[model samples]
Target: MAIRGYHAHLYFDPHEVGHARAVAEAAQAAFGCPVGHFHTAPVGPHPRGSVQLSLRPEQFAQFAAWASEGREGLTVFAHGLSGDDLADHTQYVIWFGTSEPLDLSIFG
Candidate 1:
């Protein structure tokens, strides 16, 4: 089966929080979707400052394409929300740039 929706985690360095925020905001504008909190510290198992956006499957391909335009050096970690957190974050995810270490045990 195809994916239902996705959660895109936009990770950034400490000094680039603003840039990340702008990227998230631009994504919201470009896609007309909701952008989640801009986190300075690790949220749950995430290893860096991150912002999240939930995208329906219909929106995924376009969003991924737009993101590949190199939205100012942000590392995008996107995964499907298939009711299986572990697999979603691990096996079914797409990484645009370096992947960060996540404390996946939280999903247990």
Candidate 2:
């Protein structure tokens, strides 16, 4: 390992709270790391909307189907996200694990 390490952050706009929250909960239970934060708010002047799974600057790639900044490994922690079917708000997924993540531009 190098003297320094890197991490990533991701924002997702799910359409369902239960779905999104499930993903977050699953991640927390699976990973030894903390879940960081989770919350909900309104969008476009409407009421009763929620966007879950907000990652800190430090849980993004664990659920990324693709890679961004790390070497390919058989130890991938993806392919296990749950309840992730919400709408268009913004939930940042911050990953601080040892695996490097793919760049954000790829998502664009």
- The candidate that achieves the highest lDDT relative to the unseen native structure: 1
Q: Candidate 1 has what TM-score?
A: 0.92
> Which pairs of residues collide in model 1?
none
Query: What is the model-wide C-alpha lDDT for candidate 2?
Result: 0.33
Please state the error at residue 103 of candidate 2 in Å.
18
**1-108 in candidate 1: lDDT tens per residue?**
456899999998788898998888899999987998888988887899888999998999999999887466788999998887788888889988888899898988
Q: Among all windows of ten consecutive residues in candidate 2, which has the lowest summed lDDT?
A: 1-10
In the order shown, the candidates' Cα RMSDs to the true structure are: 1.3, 12.9
The alpha-carbon root-mean-square deviation between model 2 and the true structure, to one decimal in Å, is 12.9
Q: Count the backbone clashes (under 3 Å) in each candidate.
A: 0, 20
